[model samples]
Each structure stands twice: as structure tokens, then as C-alpha cells.
Target: MIVDESIARPIAASEAHTIEADVAIVGAGLAGSLARAVLVRAGYRVVLIDKRTVPPDEFRVEKIGGRQLDLIRQLGFINDLEAVGAPYNRVLNIRDGKVVDISVGQAFGLSYASLVGMARGLLSDPTSFLIDQVTGISCSDDRQQLELASGKRVTSRLVILATGMASPLAYSLGIKRRMLAERHSVSFGFTIARPDNAPFEFDALTAYGERTADGVDYLSLFPIADGMRANLFMFRDPTDPIMRELRRDTKRTLLRLMPGLQRYLGDFDVVGQVQSWVMDLSVVEGHLQPGVVLIGDAFQTNCPAAGTGVSRLLVDVERLCTDHVPRWLETEGMGADKIAQFYSDQGKLAADRHSLDMARFRQALTLNNDARWSARRKLHFLRRMITHRVDRIHPGWVTRVRGALR
Candidate 1:
């Protein structure tokens, strides 16, 4: 099925009542909820369905900033972001017990559950969100139907699958995930606090691996609403004994791995349970079909260390919800031809490519020990050190230079 990207089917308000909504979004994760907000605010009837009324306190993407903030602002949710997230601006990057560089930018920290809840709250009419699991889905060019676990059914002109990885719904529709990298990265998430309940010297910090053999990428510490959140990313086998050691003795294991972190963080204790995730880089196959579109982890999985999950999903939501869905609804049929426009969109394609590229880049940059990579690794940190020195001599000089170039 081939559809012209230039054609936009005229909007017909009378036809919106024929179905439950102009679009039915399945899954209420960050991607799904944001899509619903965009479509509904644009005057389209949208039904957002999910199994859990509240998103679980999962160890998903817990921070947002940089390009992610730019997109969220474009969608008119920057104020909402301020409402729910802890804002921070400085990230001290360190390696081998020495400062490498400092990253200064606007960033926010929050739990995945709270982020999703805030996004879902953006929809004006709360009734549009359905709290039910999708048991089955049937798709066609003209209409799509959803069978819920609670015996409720929904029909819409278009179906947006924002279900995260492990989606039986997408698999049932003949969509399969092509694993780009299996068990590519192992990440640990937990909260930490000073034993005396005192504030740390730095607001946010990142410590890179001193030795490549440790397979450590970096350990990022930042502020969340609960406490100081720490995310440790590594390129190592999940089945390795170190995984158990990290879970049992997080403080000692972390210090042994990145001893430099000790100076910046003075005597802290893990506040709660440690949550770990073994991420597999993957993309959806056989998804450009009629009546359905996949977004977020439903379409692709990202490496946490790469920090591209939120950016990629934001691109998916913006391109599909803001551009493609409205046009598809106007034309009457949700065929592959219409869906292909989104798949071929230059912006979406670039974001997906950058995600995969960064996943491989981070893994190789951390673990690859070839002569070429060895030199590349040295140059990487050396460049950062040089830049830091230059910036120290003239504060905000780097920022001004980059801004002028832009």
C-alpha cells in the first residue's frame, strides 16, 4: 500500500461520533499519553486505554532534558514538566578520580510513573482515558476494533500502539521485533542519600569507567522527588556474578568500580531496593500495516546509557499525532499507505537511527579494545579535558561559541 504524503483528507466533524473516537491509543506510557494529549487538544476525539490506572514505579527513563525538553515544549507541556520534575542544570562528568568536563543545561528528574501521570493529566477530559487491558485487536483499512479484557470493545478510525516492549498485541498483528543487540546493556536504578541526611556537594554527577575491562559506561547520580537517584549503566553480561554483587553490596561495588565517585559523594547509603534492567536494542518488523502504528518501546527499544529513549519516542509522538494521524482520519481508511508516511518521515527516521547508532557507539566505546578504539577512547576524554580547561579560563565561552554556530 502506497500513500502520498502531500495529501491531507479533509476533516469532517460529523463523522467523529460514528466511532468511539477519531483515534484509539493503546497503552498509556509516556508515548501513548503524550500522543493522546496532542490529538485530543487538536479537537480529535481520542480514547486512551491502558491496563493500570497508575503507571508502576518502574525503572524506566527517569530524566528528561536537552532535545527531549525542546520537543515537550513544542507540544505545549513545558509548564506541566516544571510542575512534576526536579530541575537541575549542572552535570559534573568525571573519570579516573579527576574532573573531565561539566555539562550545563536545563534538565528535569522524575520517576517514570510520575512522568506518565503528568502527561496523561494533560488531556482536558479525563473520561477519554480507559482503564482496561486490550485483550485483542483487529485492524483494517476502514476501521479498527479493540477487545478489552473487561469485555469492553472500542472502535476508532485509527489505532496507535504505544505499548512498550513485550507486546503480545503487536505480535498478534504479525509484528515481530528484530533484535539489533541482545542483552546489550545492563542498568541499575536506585535512590541514595547521605547517611546523616545532609545535601551532597554536587546537584548531579556522572562518573565514567576508569578501566575498559570493567565494562562500565558510567554511573549517573541526580535528584528525583524521592531522593538522589543513581543509574549505573554497563556493557557486561547480565548473568555475570558481578550482577549479584551489585545487588547485594551496591555501595562497595560502586566505589570499587568508580572509586573517584567517593570524593563528590561523601558516605551515602542506598535508600531502597535496587531495580535493574537488561536492555535489548530492537526495532519492529512488519509494522507498516493497515489501521495500526507502533510508537515508543513498541516500535524500538533503546540503551539507557545512550539516553535516546525519550527523544526517539517524542519524535514518534510528534510526527504521528501532530502530522500523520489527523490526515489519515480525514481520508477514511487507515491503510499501510497512510502509515508509511510516518515510517518514512525524515525526522522519525533520523531519531531512530541516532538511537541505534548511540547504543552501538556507547557499547563499543566502553568495551571495544581494538587498537583503533583504544586511541578513540583516549582522544574522547582528552578532548573533554581540553575543552574543560578552556571553559574554565573563560566561563560560558563554550556555550556562547556553540550558540553562535547554531
Candidate 2:
């Protein structure tokens, strides 16, 4: 069912000037592609449109773990994910050149492109995908229409916008993004390997910032199919000279920022391009409408440092596709009232709220030098270190005590 992009043909090539479907998903990114697969497997006709046949190498969510893994399993895409991602079960957490704890869990590392590719490949019918741009959308309470640049049109009962941040298509529909925090965080992504091509001392590692002034949240190193991948997150100004240094002289500037990395990483060189992204924390307004709904970054944007983007999108996908869409389709119309239900869904609301909350929490924890925050930061790490030591000594004592307390 994995359609090769090289041999993939547009649905328009079949001499069909118009297509009809139960759902039309715009933007074949992670969210749209996954939504299409879910709906298709559920016996709904889905038409997915995107400009690119192949997902370009982009600096986006490059790893999946924690609740994200659980959501993927719940959506039945874990096997597809496992086929494309490299797995790591332990991450050595360190601060100030010392071991704070070891986080044991299942996580996968892969390029965002491969991740999206895997999702798109889950479609049993390759002809459902359209490699073209959406020029216009006309929506009503009963049905919606999409005008593609290829001069073809698609009519569907429901439309899902997964076009991501700064979507001109959403803006054209009068859906505006309200900036909660502009330039909220800066993130760097790249691969690294020792000169001798040897693996690192640990299966995975996380080096926390040594000083609040450094504005570094953490540097996470994990395994990908290509090599060891590194993600450096910071709360500093995107325009700072350090940003330039990190890109130009990655290893040296990285070592200078967190000297402790030298011990664990040893002598390593950054492989391939160093991709950087400055994120803005924002959410959509005026999105409630007939025949349409927004999901993923189209609805809200998340701070990369918070690691909540994937979880939020997965929640959006799960709630809308599995719970909301099926029921909505069975009913008469796709109205603002019906669309409002998804926006008000408790699970979606919580995920959206949690992503923003964690965004602010991470920024404050990294750069807030106020006496109260400083003390709080110290206590946070100290608590983790203590718990890790205790767990190591007594094994299941912490788990048992936590269970009893709960």
C-alpha cells in the first residue's frame, strides 16, 4: 500500500474534472495524511491534496515518544511508525556534567519527512492522493468545494485543514492566528558522529543547561537510521549572536554553551545541514464554520522545547477522526454547531491548553532568574536526582509509594 512517489499519479490524470468524497483533507503533512488513512480505512472516501509528492527534509518534530507513542498505537499506526523509525529505550539525563537520572521508556527517532511518508504510505488506495495546490475553498452547511490549481474541483461533505502555521488558505477564510508568544523559542536539529565513526557512550543522552543565562533548555541526543540525531532547544532571542555561532561553528559553540557535552559526546562533528527554527506560540480564532475544521498546527502552534506538538496533533486527529467525524458524517449537515463540538471537546481542549501551558513553563524554567523561580528550578532537578537515586537503591519503592499516595 506504500505508493512510490516516483510512480504516483495525480487523480486528475484519470480524465476526471471533478471528484466526490466524504472528506477532503488539505495538506498531506503528518496530520492530513494520517487523517486520510484513518478515514479511508473506516470506509469513507477521502481526497488528500498537497503541493509536493515527497515530504521535504524539514526542521519539525523529529522524534516520537511519551504520550505520542501511545496515541500512535491508539490510532493503529505504531507498526508503520516502527518500520521507519529507530528505537531507543533509555536516555541518560545529565546536568552540570553530572548524571541526574536515566529515563527509561520507548521512543523513536526519524526524520519528519520519513515520518510523513510512512503515514501517507498507509493509504490502501494511492489514487486518493492529489499532488496539487488548493487555490480556493467554498464551504456551506451541506457540502464543501475545493478548487485546485490543476483546474479540477473536489466536492465533499467535510473539509479538514491541516495546512500548518501561517496558512494563507485559512487566512483567506477569515481564520486568523492570534500570537500568544512571538519568537517563543529557538530549536536546532542535526546529526552527529565521532571522527572514528564510533557510537556514543550512552544509548541516548540529555544535557541540561548549566546556567540560566545560557537560555538552553536541553540538548537531546538519540539514534536515527542515519546517525545519532541531536536537538538543541533554547529560550534565548533568535537574533542573538549565539544563534549564528551555533549554526556556523556547531560543535565548538555547542561545547562552549554546555561544556559537559564534551565528556559524553567526546570528539564529534556535526553531519549534514544544521537546521534551525524560531517558533511562535499561537492559536487560531474564528475557525468555527460550516463544512470545515482545522487540526494540528493549523488550529494551534506549540513550542518545540515543550515537546507537546506531536501529542496535541495526535489528540486532534484521534478526537476528530475516530469520535467526531464518523458521527458527524452520519448526521445531516456539517454546520458551525457540529464543528463547534470538536473545538469544545474536552480532550482536544485539554491538549491545546496543556501545550500552551508547557510552552510557558519551559521558557520560564529556562530563563526566569527571579529568586522564586531560581529556587523552584533547583528543587525541580534536586527532586528528580533524589528520586532517581532512591529508585536505583530500592527498585520499585518509588513506584509503590506513588501508587499508594495516588
Candidate 3:
């Protein structure tokens, strides 16, 4: 799925006059950028507004695969993704010092900033992007207006709130983030390389905690352009001393948490700054207003360990940009009824519900100590191990049987 490679550059300082468009998306992150690309190519006068033209390096989704990859392909950016990301075909999964299973699939890894850049680069018209902070917004059924920090005005028929988590802009419009779960999960992002700067034994690997009490869900190691990136997801208190130890003596504490890692990974050095994030499971309330719609993290937050963030955002982008937004644009006024159609979209609803459900499921799987859950945890891995053994004995048998059943 390839589209036009040419991109419109960011708005120049002199060209930052009044911005006008059919849709004004506030936030130049993944959601906003992707939406702008789609709308602009569809011949809609779209303006993407954000504070930063160059997104800073941040600890966000560094790798994407499975349904995430499929969604990107559907969005017609698979070729662009291939150009910017490092791809791997196999992931060796281990737990309790033994192989659990081998996941064979396509995946890609890169920095979050690079991913955003790639999205922004999809713009066919450079002037469609405005690198300015939004200070105020006024929405109505017929039209919407925005006041920027630079005293410029942007008027559009519709507004998209994709400012992600912690948006004062959304709060200004009386949209509140209801915390479903606070400090739901803690995650770590960093890079690791062999002492000799060589590649690791595997192209990609994942090691789960031996004991549930350790609070670690898993350590996922994958190849990025820079090096092997490590994303450690855990269900632990952010203030715990173990968190400090992880930041200070990352390699040591990581090995201590998953001793089995050493046998497979040997000795590796953390090559870059250690980044961390504490995620809260939350959803937006009072967002069903005229002329404005919430998307991505602006609509709901996801548990990183669950690995549903990409899927959720992709669904938001795909359903809203490809389906609902176009239909709304063809009509007269952007009202609450029109906006509700997107929130009520079956695919969007399923993605949103699944993201929340997976968040809770992952947390429970990692931290629950109940007798039933403990038994479930054992059976989960046991099933994987058994299936892996069976597959090893007869290659492609699992695929044949599963496909036939389907």
C-alpha cells in the first residue's frame, strides 16, 4: 500500500497568517497527522495544528505488528513504514528459563518521533500544517473557530481533538478525563547492545517474569535502526524502590528480575537514556459536542503492556477519517448527532472496548493473585508450550488445522 511520497513542508513563519480549512485538527501527533494526510488527499481543506513541528524523542509505541501493521497497510502507508522502520520476522519467546514459543510474523521497530515524522511527511500540501499552539477554541453546529498562541485565527467546519493525554485544550471545552484506573501500568524504554556493539543472538525476543510477585509482565527486545530496543512493561507501583533500581542499575535489576535473560542475551549494555512512563486507564467524558470529536489518546488511554494502543488509534484514524468524517463533510452542519455517529461506529466501538478490556486483562494476568487467576496463568503458558511442541513436531500443522477450523 503505497501513496504519494512527496510531502508539503511545515508552514513558514511568514505564512502563519489566518488558517482556514474544512477541518482543523489540533495536535500534530500520529492521529492528527494521519488524519490530515487522508483528508488533504481527498481534496478537503484540512489544517493540522500543533505546538511542535519536530516532535521530541519520547517513550511511546516503538514497535508495531499484527493488526497494527494491517491497519497501517489499509491506510496506504506500508511502503513508507518499511522505509522508516527496521523489520524482523521472528520473535523468540521465553519464560522461567525455557522457551515458551516462537512467534513468526512481520513486525517493525523505530523511535516514536520517527513514526510521527513519517506520518507528517504524508501531507501532499505543506501549508496544510500549522506549527502553533492552540490557546482557545469555539465550536458550534455550523462552524468552528480556534485562537492560537500567536494571535492567529483558524476557522473550520469541524475540529478534531487529538492532543493526546493531558490536554488542557479538551478540558477548556468541559471535556473531562474520567480515570478508570490510576497508575495502571509502568513501562520502561531504552536501547541495549552487545558489549562489542554487535547484534544479539535473536532478531527479536521476549522474556517474561518467572514469578508474579516481581510485578514484571515481560521484557520485549526488538531491532530498531539505532539498536535493539527494550520495552519493559510491569504492573508495579511507580514509587517502589524496585523502580529506582531499575532506572539506576537497569541491566542488573533486569537480570535479577528475569535471570533467564542472561543465558539467552548474554551480556548487553544499555546504550541510551532510560525513559519511563506511568499510564492511567482513562476515557473522555462530555466529549459528544458539536463541531468537535476526540480521537486517539484524547478519547481513551491504553495500557502499554496490553499492546492495544496502536490498534485503537488506527481504528480511530481509519473509521473517522475514511468513513464518518467524509460523510459529515458532505452535509451542512457539524452537530452532536453527526459527531455521535463516529463514537457509535461499530468498528470504533469494538476497538475502544477491546482496548479497555485488554488493559484490564493484561493487568490481571500480571498482578492477580487469586487462586483462579493463578491457575489460569499456568494454563495459559502451558497451552502455549504444548502447542509450540506440537508445531515443532509438524511444521505448518497448526496453521492448517486453525485455518480449516476457521
Candidate 4:
């Protein structure tokens, strides 16, 4: 999601040397943009900066949760989004062409939200809410200042690092968090270049725990963003040649890997790129010092396969900028270091929970091929029996339980 805004003309010496504001943001990714939006509305002289402004256009958050969408609408981008999205309702886990498990997704019974396929532009468009973009941040003497790649320096009183996974400014503050490489990464299923604009079925999501002759586990395929496309995601074995093909010739590899997809997306041409969560951010925990705070993935999000990173970040920001920050501003003033510890504590708990859940899910899919497959089936049944209790703790996860019961 990085852009190259370096082509902009050079500025005057006066303007290029020094700049200052009340708040300085480091990155312009999804979380950063949202952080900027909330701050601007709060009347803080905000200076949001990024290394670049290239703007994204391909895969973004496939479909946001209910609360996340509300923020986008508040920021005035939902209207721009409707044109590309198709309502997604159900989650189906199929096996060899038969429906093995039907997940009653959130949309079926409640006022749950829908997910859509989006271009990167929709994900990174919060520049309007900032004082200036295409600027980088650095410290000028004793105070914090922003130095654009173009050599423009802007200073600020309170600096907020919404900078994503790689926070250059936060690193400067001596907060370098580390993450595991996603060799065991999660692969997202997507589709592109379908024949028609017809809506994807409300019952669109499906998972297949199937094994090939070599015993590789992969997810089943279904339509996304209207019936225009469908996809199957399997654990890519580095040893397999298809893994290489899947990256370069995804259209052909998808059809070759699993025959099930051919029936659903055969007529229309399918296009896509394989996305993985290779970045596991565990560093930068101490990035928040007396003057700054690290929110979102910049702090720590999740391991591979857990889809809770974005949601948890949104929740973290909502709690911090909305509730906690104001209280601190009134009572003890700013202790950015304490705030970072507080967020890391809360965020780690959430991340741990998601990591465990994804581990269980991966185990569930893996079990079908193991001798413990029967035990796994019993475990799934037991989970279905106590879904209500689980739902309270996992609003997003309970949907999958319902999918299983149906």
C-alpha cells in the first residue's frame, strides 16, 4: 500500500526546512487514515505523513465488519464503495461437491454487515482529513518534526504513529517490534474478470478441507463480489510446482489445483493474485514513549490466518483516541509511553485469542486427513452445542458455528 509521490515539484526553502502541528501521524494505511479522520474531526491541528502517496488499486480488505463499515461511511467513502461490493451472507464448507457444513453467517439472522471486494484506492483515501501528505516525520533538535521525502519538515506537539506494520518514525523513537515471517501464512481467496455483474449469492463463503494425493490441505471455492468470480485457497507447499504457477499464472493454476472451482467459475474468466500474511509484527511494543503512541498493527495485530487484526486495531483506536486519550489529557496529561503499554497489553490479549482461534480452525481443517478426524468431528459438534456462550466472547466466530449447524 505504498505510493511514490516523489514526482511533486520542489518547494520553497522556507517551506521545506520546517513545519509544525499539534499531532503528527506516520503512515497513511487503513488504520492511519482512520486515525487521521478521528483526530481531524476532534479539532487537533493534525499533520498526517507517509513515505509515499502511490495509492493502492488491487486487493484491499475484502469485506469490512459492521462497525468498521460505519467508520468508512462516517469518513464519506461508503458511497464510493457500493458500486464494487456484492452482499455476502453465508459461509459454506463443501467436500467433494457436497455441502459438508453450512455456517449461518451473521447476515442471515441479525443486522450483521456484508463484505465486498474493493480496490486499494478505497482502502487508503484519508488524505483529505490531513494538513499535508507525502511528508515523512523526524525530530528537529528537541521537538518532533515531519520531514517529507521531498525535504519538507513539519513539527507537532502530540505525535500519533498510525504508521502501519513498518513504522519508520516509531523506529526512530527506539521502538522496534519484531514479527515472525508468515511462512505458515494465511492465503485469501479472491476472483477477478468474471463475465457478468450479477450479485454473488448471499450464501457465498465456503471452506473445503480436502487433501490431494500428497495430503495438502486447502479451502474450497465460492463466488466473491457478485458471481463474477470464485476461488479455492489451499496451503501452498513450497515443494509443489503449482505454488510457483499459482503466483504467476493464478488463472490457470486455480483451475488445475481443484476441479470443484471449474464448475462454479468455468464460464467466466477468473483472475487473481495470491496474498499471504508473511508479516508477523511483534516488535515496536515500546514504540510509545512520553510523546507518542502506537496503535493498530504498528503496535501488534495478529499472527497468520486470523482475520481479527483490522477489527482489533479499530477497537484499539476507538478506545484510545475516543475514551482513554481524553481521560489522560484531562487527568495526568500525556504519558505516551504508558499509553503504549496499555494498548499493547489490551491488544496482545486480543491477538492471543485470535491466534488461538485460528490455530484451532487450522487444526479443524487439518483433522479431516488425520486419524483424529472422528475426534475432530466430535469437537466440532460439541462447539456447535455451546455456540451461545462462545458467541458472547466471539461475535465474528459464532457466525462460523452457525454455519456448521446449518
Candidate 5:
């Protein structure tokens, strides 16, 4: 594993004026950093560039579990992830003050900055990272060039845009974002602590919204290094008055919206700043160009409420770095024909489609008051509650039945 390599050795300032590599990635976030690590370990000379020296304290994805953890292990970074993140194996799921089901699995919680930092630290050659804004980019089937803000230039055989939701550079290349849904969902992030600074009774907890009128999907509370981190996902309008109230008086607003949470939380106060994001579900058009490729949020945005953002980006990184890029590098040119193979990959296409579908399903389940959806909403919780009860009564019975059906 790359983690066993010596610590990163940064390049001198003088040697960075002109750089060359087989691949030049424009963003050093999780997606870009992971790509650089994978390519470098495969013996490809890769350069990763970002304007910020340190990843900003952003309120992005804060937890990884399930398929996300599987992908991390597949990339050989599970040990590194366990080192930096706080892990929990059980999550008590509840709705309207009653237990729905208990989710048992390995998961980790950490801030976005720390997560990106872990990815960046995987590169033994820190010199491959450039801290300068890209002023312009020009690409062709044979090669690509990038102009930097510090008067440096980077020449490479391929360029990858993992710039997240920002699209200025992609726009310059005639690529545009096509909004599928505007103001599709809103999310809130913050930390909470008990009055006495004591630990909560459960390992982790998820409280689902009791009423459709509240517009809330769920409130997830998990343990980070500092304290319990809270992520509240909603389908409400971003401009609603409740949004302001949630920011100003978080604890009170949360209790009023989901009264069942009070019994579980037991007099907790909101700590630090409350960060919120309004997401517009979108994807890029006209991105199939020579010498350039889009991945992660640079290519598409997902509804945070659905919890599919990390899953989609991890799929993008695994498929591009492991399967597509190597095959493209074996050939002479980085043409659209080669780049098209990645977009058409079965695994990539399935992930992208599943993200969009999950986003729409979460919104309908949370806010739709139609007769059919209402019945489904009830059955959803009821089914889980019944299964949980049966599991307690007959240990391993549910697992045996599910395995037989599969």
C-alpha cells in the first residue's frame, strides 16, 4: 500500500515554474487527490493542482460507510481512513420517538477538510502538487497546456477537471452545466454537545421527520473527533423563514420541527457555526473533448439528502483511474474517442443513474402527500420496525431468510 511509503517530500519553489507530467489534475479535493495517488502508485507521473494550500473547512460529506467503505478498501486506503476518522459500528435508527431499526456496520465520521487532507497526504511526492490558480487551459488530441496564476505552465498528455461545483475553466472550453432541478434540496451541518459534556447513550442516532409539513427528511447525529456532528437534510425552500430560524436558534428550531428528538438528545446545545448548502441537481453537457475529462462534482451534482454524493465520486475515481486512464495512456493521443469510453462505462453509468433516482425518491418520500406515497411512507417505517422486533425475538432468523431469498 502507498501509505507505507516515506513521508511526502515537497518540491522547491524554484523548480515549479515549469512542470510536465503524464496527467495534470486541476483540483486537489478528494477526487483529484485520490486520482493522483492511484496513478502515481501505478508508475505514472501525475501533477495535482489547487489554489488553496490547505483544504478549507467546508461542510461537505462528513461520513463514509456501506459501499463507500467498500470502494475505499478496494483502493487500498482503508487503513489510512481508520487512522484519521472516528469509527462507529452501530446506529440506532428511530422515527417519532420510536425505534425503526438498528443499522450495524463499520462507518467513520470526520470533517471534509480532514478527509481531503488524508487523501493528499497519500502522495509521497508532494512536489506533484501545485498551489496556484489555473488562468487558462488549451487542449488538443496530442497534448494539453495550462497557464497558472503564478506565471507557471504545466504541459501534460491529459487534464482532469475535479473542481467540484465550480465550472469557470470548463465553461471556457465550451462545456456548460444543464440544471436538472433548481433549488432541489437544502442541508444544514453543525456540532452538538450535552449540557454536561458527557457522551450520548447510543453510538450514533438517526431521527426521521414525523410530519410531511415540516419538510425535513432526517437528522443524523454521529461522533467526530471533537463532538457529535449533526447533519439535517430537508426538502424545504432555501428562502423560507424557517431556514433563518434554524441557523439563528438551531436547538429550538430542531426540537420544534422534530419534537421526538428532545427525548433522545436530552438538553443539548448547538456548538460552533452552523453551515448550510442549497443544492441544484445538475450535470454537464458537451464535456467530451480532446485531452480533457470531467469527474466527481465537476461532472454532476447530487442531492445531499439522498447521501449519494460520496458514492458517485468514489465510483468516478475508481473507474477513471483504475480502468480508463491506463488504457488511454497506452495509446498515442487523448482524443474524445478515448475519453468517451469512461462516460459509457457500465459501472459509471449505473452509479450516475442511481444517484439521480435516489435523489428524486428521497424528495417524494419526505414531502409528497399523495395517497400512494403516503402509504409507502408508512410502510417504509413499519416494515423496518417489524423486522427489528423479529430480529430481537429470533436472532439470525432474518439473516437466514434474506440469504435464502437472494
Candidate 6:
């Protein structure tokens, strides 16, 4: 069987679980939990479920975005982030030394220091509050429900399928599920000491100083868990020569990506095992049924390499709860348009805009083109320049932005 981290403990394909809730939420990951929180704050009772009793941060980037850094502070999860985490500030965009784009820590105008690090839990209290962690879900016109493997059932008024790409519950509810075996990729390396420490220990950096023959793919470096950790990623397009040099597994992948770290293996051993996912480009346009809301990963699983996964999901939640739900709930004859609009808007943003941006970034930095590299240099400089101007004109912006800047 293909290895899947869909659960805390892997289960055979035959295993069947059941449950229900007022708002039955599937998946305990970031998107699922955040959506649950929004619904609960709106005064709806939620019964959240996931296949695994104890979900681990297995394949996650474990790094949050500029917007989420703000959300985390408001959600009261900042302490949780501090209890188990690292911070980031600098971003290094490198390409064979000829083209280098470095955004110094907190020195960029638009760049809010983002949050990158491990956390005590999932940092998803909204759904975690209910925390049933069941496997399967079944909803009807009358009410919604979830089914755990042990035969436990919980019911709710509405159902949110935040269950992510791993959910078979998706197919059961008539949501078309597809997978892209390629295009989904990531790698990590560790740095035990600070890069010339000062008053701060947390900063983020990105590097892509190498490129392949076609110039469509390259390798990159970014910080996670503040300056305490670093990740080296090898992105290769189909024809790229770098693909031939990929390490089959995660550990070898790291070493293959960054040979310089060979001496420090023991100092900062891999804290989490190497993990990969299909990085599916699938989208559910309109579910085959009503009363089933596909939120977060269940709806679409974008590339996490860009560090925008969490931010996109938050944008999804904001659009849905703020716009669609109220009208749909009150409508006597609600059609697919009720929910489809929000989902469609998000899907377009993902497939067309975000996806292209990630692809461009993966190509520009990864493939090692001179023009692309120079363009990136100007952009980072422009961004930081704009940020500085805004800061002098508005000191409050920098303070608020700095907290989110990792």
C-alpha cells in the first residue's frame, strides 16, 4: 500500500470509521481547524473530526505566513507558537552568486517578518476545541454526522469537509478527486548556530543560486523555526538535469541538496522525518450534493513551497463565512451557485494566479536565468524600498508588520 500520513497511525484501506456533529468538520490540519474556529465564533456549535486521534506535524512546512502571524496573535496561539517554535526575518534569493536578492531582517517595506517554526500543537484551536478525530463523515438534509472507525457517531446542523487531500470522504460525498503525482516537492537542511547573532534570533532567508539546463527549475533555501532551522529544496522540471540528481528519500535528499551540511549532521539532526505528498492540482467545482461544504485542503491542495498555503486557506475561510453561508442558509431553493461562487473564485486564484506565481518562482529561482534573477533582485529591492518609505511615514505600520515578518 502507498504510505499516507492521513492519520496519526496508518490504517488499512478496509478500516471504516463513523461520527457526527452540529457542524461536522473533517481534518484536524490548519485549514480544518481555522474554518471551525470561524464558524464557532459566529455562534455555531461544531463537532470536528479527523481520522487520527493524535495528528502530527509530519509533512507540514511548519512555517506560517505574514497574514497568519497576525491571525495567530489575535487567536491567542502566539504563546503556543512561542512554547514550541522558531522565528524568521531575512530572505536570501540567490542564483550562483551572479544574481542575489537578499531582504535583510525587518528591513523590507512590504515584507512583514513571517513566522516559521514548529509549534506545541497544530495551532488550530477552533476545531481542536471539539477534537473527536474520527475518520468518516455522512451528512443528510436533516442534519450532518461523522463516523469513527470504532462505530462512534456525532451529529451537527452543518458539515464542513476540511479533511484535506487524504480524505476518501470526499469521493463518498460526490466531490471529484484527482491527484498530480508531480509538481509537489520539498526538502530540508539544518543549521545549529546563528548567522552572526545580534538582538534577535529569528529570521527567514530564501536561496536559489543553482539552476538546471532548461533553466526552468532550481534549488532553494529558507528558514524554519526561526534561525534554528534551515530547509534546502531541490525543484526540477521534467527535462531539468537536476532531476537526475534527486535523493530518492528525504534524508539523502537533504544531503544531496546541501553537501556542505555533511559535517553538522549530528549537531542538528533532522527533527522531523522527510515527507512528500502528491501536491494535487485538483479542484471541486460544485459538489454533487448540497449541505456539504468543502473547505481548505479538501477543496484544493496548493504547493506549500511558496509559504502561502495557510494564507490562502485563511482567505478562503474569510470569503466563505463572510459572504456565502448566510445567503445559502436563508434561501428556500439554494443551488450550487450559493457555495460554488466562493469555491470557484478561490480555485481560479489558485490555479491561475497563485499557481503561476509559484511556477514562475520555481522556474526563475530554480532554473538560474540571468534576466529572471535580475528581475527578482529589482522586485525585492522595490518591495523593501516601499516598506521603508511607509515605515518613516507610518511607524505603526512597521510595528504591526514586524510582528508578522518572520
Output the lDDT of residue 159, model 5: 98
Query: What's the TM-score of every candidate structure?
Result: 0.94, 0.96, 0.96, 0.68, 0.96, 0.64
Lowest summed lDDT across 10 adjacent residues in model 5 is found at: 1-10
Between prediction 2 and prediction 4, the one with superior TM-score is 2
* 312-382 per-residue lDDT for model 1 (tens digits): 99999999988887677666677899989999999999999999999999999999999999999999999
Shift of residue 377 alpha carbon in model 3, Å: 0.7
Residue runs of model 6 more than 4 Å from their true location after superposition: 1-21, 70-84, 97-99, 104-137, 140-142, 179-181, 184-186, 189-204, 214-227, 237-278, 285-288, 326-337, 344-352, 368-406
lDDT of 4 by residue, 177-214 (tens): 65543444335444555466444443554534444342
Candidate 1 Cα outliers beyond 4 Å, as residue runs: 1-19, 403-406
**Residue 41, model 3: Cα distance from true site in angstroms:** 1.2
The digit string of per-residue lDDT tens for model 2 on 1-406 reads 3323422323343358988778899999999999998877777777899999899789998999999999999999999999999999999999989999999999999999999999999976777898999999999999999999989999889999999996888888899999899999999998999999988889899999999999999999999999999999999999999999999999999999999878888789998999999999889899999999999999999999999999999999999999899888777889999999999999999999999999999999999999999999999999999999999999988889999999
What is the lDDT, from 0 to 100, of the residue 305 in candidate 4?
42
Residue by residue across 114-231, what tens digits does model 5's lDDT show?
9999999996676788888999999999989999998998888899999999879999999999999999999999999988999999999999999999999999999999999999
Order of candidate numbers by TM-score, starting with the best: 5, 2, 3, 1, 4, 6
Q: What TM-score quantifies how close candidate 2 is to the native fold?
A: 0.96
Q: List runs of model 2 lying over 4 Å from the truth.
A: 1-13
Superposed model 3: Cα runs more than 4 Å off: 1-17
By lDDT, the better pick of 2 and 6 is 2
Whole-model lDDT per candidate = 0.89, 0.91, 0.90, 0.51, 0.92, 0.50
What TM-score, to 2 decimals, does candidate 5 have? 0.96
TM-score of 3: 0.96
**Span of 10 residues, lowest total lDDT, candidate 4:** 108-117
